[model samples]
Target: MVISLFFILPIVSIIREIGYLITSKIFGAKKSKITIGSGPKLFHLSVFEVRKYYFAYSWCSYDSLRNESKLAHIIIYASPILSNLLIALLINGLLAYELLGLPNFWNKFVFYSFYFVLFDALPIYYPDGQPSNGRVIYNLLRYGRKSDFERNDPQIDIKKTDEK
Candidate 1:
């Protein structure tokens, strides 16, 4: 449980956030960042930040995209879910073939990876009004843009800074 909670969970969270970072970069986001965990900052380097409670939560933020289009937004929103799913599938396939060692560890990792994917793919708004990736994707397809609440939600949209 300890290994699953701290080691496997945080690694899976980072992988999920990397999905967002990579897709946002592909879409030409001028600035992008991945914040892992919550609470006070532990350290940050380049586009990644690790907080004190390093497995509690994680998120990705980016400035405006150069190719700002509905399709791009939809894909970006779906990236994390896709990434987690892909990892889970790949791991499961390997396990099925008995191609990887440390079966127990791999099983735990696969479980957490799917757990993240399942929750992230659910189309629901969080308590703080932040929409899940699935919710954002649904809105993008149904309305051609983020909903009014998402537009104003600080958690969803990173405020632009004047710093160079």
Candidate 2:
């Protein structure tokens, strides 16, 4: 159980990316790349880059950021947590079935899945003081438009980022 739990952590990042991909596709955005972890490439599973570091971080990029609605972007950002939460709920339900009662491993997996998703989706800052994904969305909701977002977001300068 412990060994599997250790293995599960790394895969969680992949699961989040899968969620992102699905949501992006549904919203008609083209995904350009997906990178899991943060180091030299261990290998390639198709387009996915499996890095030396695992379970630390993951990112998915879309080909074009232009012409996307605010709501669409919000859905793309929130998809990971939403999908993970769905999976956790599904597993929890399965575990509850009387004839198919699984062991503690499944229960623990569901718990960790919920924990990771909530951790990312919450607005709380990390140790490095970066805003969570949910916080980013909150900021976007507050700003309402790209022009406003660029004006307010310190990380994004409109003059520098403006494609026009």
Candidate 3:
């Protein structure tokens, strides 16, 4: 139960992103969450980033994480990936558990499986299967770093990143 609860924390933390976007738009902060829509994605990207970071801080308020650092925001941006993977693994684990002749809460398994599988189909993802959010952007930028070089982030200007 304790182990299940610990892993559950990360999955549940995704709500932070949802709240902040809603917060910025409803109340307006760094800027108005919406734009004139010049038919360009960059406009939307800017708006979304602000809202995301805003909600990310909301996560902090929720005792979700210590703070919403640039790196943390990147993780928050890639949260859906973690969440999607978490759900898939959970479903697979549950199914495997059943196959192994163990028992779990059937109602919970059925409910989570359907939602997670559907969420896995959102309009995200870059050329790679990962979402085109801060975390994957960070990964692409810091592609060849050593394993110890851990804090990869896209909060830095992507335009300044050099391809090796």
Candidate 4:
């Protein structure tokens, strides 16, 4: 369980973020980054960042898309959920066919993957007010844009600087 929580979960989270990064790039995001974990910065290489709490939480961000469209935005938001679902299905299929060993570890991995998919696919706002991917997709389809709360919310501007 400890290994599943620390090792497996973080790996699954990273995979989920990669889904976002890939879809965002495919839609022509000017800049895309994946930050795995939270808290103080540990190290960052190009588009990947590892934080002090390397197993706590992870997220992906990107600048505005060059080929921006409703469909693109919807896909970008849904990518993580889809990725997790796909992984869970693949692993489950392998397990069903007895094509993989270590059934216990694989089962835990599949469980966590599906766990992520369920929550991410739920249309609800988090306690911090961030909307889940499902909520974002819902708004896109129903209102043709982000909800008014999102549009009216203050956004932080993160900029890179060159230091001598």
Best by TM-score: 4
Which stretches of candidate 2 lie above 4 Å from their native place? Answer: 1-5, 98-102, 145-164
The clash count for each model shown is 0, 0, 1, 0
User: Which stretches of candidate 3 lie above 4 Å from their native place?
Assistant: 1-68, 99-131, 134-136, 139-164
Could you tell which candidate, 3 or 4, scores higher by lDDT? 4
Q: Give the whole-model CA lDDT for all candidates, comma-separated.
A: 0.82, 0.67, 0.38, 0.82
Candidate 1 lDDT by residue in tens digits, 107-133 = 999999988888888888777666777
TM-score of model 3 (CA atoms): 0.29
Instruction: Assess the local accuracy of residue 94 in candidate 2 as a C-alpha lDDT between 0 and 100.
Output: 80
lDDT by residue (tens digit), candidate 3, 34-144: 321122233236444222232221121122334434444444444544554555566667676675332444334434434543443343443423343433435544563
| lDDT by residue (tens digit), candidate 2, 3-95 | 454567666667778887877877776654577776666887765877777555666766765447788878877888887788888888888
Which digits, one per residue and each the tens of the lDDT, describe model 4 over residues 66-103?
87788998898889999999999999999999999999
lDDT of 3 at 41: 31
Instruction: Give Cα distance to truth, residue 60, candidate 1, Å.
Output: 0.8
Backbone clashes, candidate 2:
0
* Deviation in Å, model 3, residue 73 alpha carbon: 2.2
